[model samples]
Target: MSKNRYSVGLIIVIVGIILLLGKLGVFGFVWGLFWPVFVLAPGLLLHFLYFNRVLPSAVLIPGGILVTCSILFFLCTIFGWSLMAYIWPGFIFAIAVGLYEFYTFDKYSPRGTLMAAVVLAILSGILFGVTILFTVGIYLIALVLIGVGAYIIFGKRRSW
Candidate 1:
């Protein structure tokens, strides 16, 4: 067989296999769950370019924000959209991450930028804590009570 014909035959086989897999829903399942990778890719590329000196540090701002938001989106996609209620604070943190990255990578970085990042991070943490507690506090309280009762019944007493 001619090399051109042989290569064409291989290409036809690969295409057939790909189509078969597509019909089986493999591609559908992957694309449905991992679509955030599309958002994450540019963020990662920007960071890579900055570190390699191919781009200015300003690019890190969007890079950091995209990376953070993509992670939040990926978490929601994998765990369920309902989890977004508890992690909504992550949006604020994403901007903070972007600002912080800029402050870190830029030689003329301003202290106010760092301050803003810190404040946003702290606010995000507080909001996340509040949301988690409100969402699941009852379960935690129940577990604590159960543990205390169990310890009283079965654990050894310590010196008072």
Candidate 2:
């Protein structure tokens, strides 16, 4: 995949899927975000570490923190220590990375778009969570997903 491959149509499909899942509920949103962080993060980090020699420390640090917190949150939830797990903080970390890449778009080399996707995914999860509080959350999430998708497809700006 070239960095220049701007698949607006593919992005629309992804956004549509996200919105549809959002309509499902909080569980859906949580699951949607989990796959990216759990799967993508590791692969991306490994690629950078092995191919770029950029060192795994940067990605692994945050990755470890997020994973640890998530596990603890799950444990707490299972043990009845908390009403529900608040995983937004992990999303916040991902957003921070997104901001870094967004600001230094040129310096990020090949992975800039992927970093932005990380941010969008995290935001989508949070939106899904918030929507859970109200019955309309799903509709709101769908709208947000559509808006972001449009921005990504047409804006041409590095930051999504």
TM-scores of the candidates are 0.84, 0.26
The candidate that achieves the highest lDDT relative to the unseen native structure: 1
Q: Taking the tens digit of each residue's C-alpha lDDT, what string does model 1 give over 20-107?
A: 9999999999998999999999999999999999999989989999999999989999999998989999999999999999999898
Best by TM-score: 1
Regions of model 2 farther than 4 Å from truth: 1-82, 85-106, 114-122, 125-129, 135-160
**Candidate 1: C-alpha RMSD after superposition:** 2.9
Candidates in order have lDDT scores of 0.95, 0.55
lDDT of 2 by residue, 1-160 (tens): 5544668767888999978777878666576445435545564564456346565334543444444445545554455554333444444555555444433433444565566656766675766566464655678879999999999889976746
**Model 1: pairs clashing at backbone N, Cα or C within 3 Å:** none
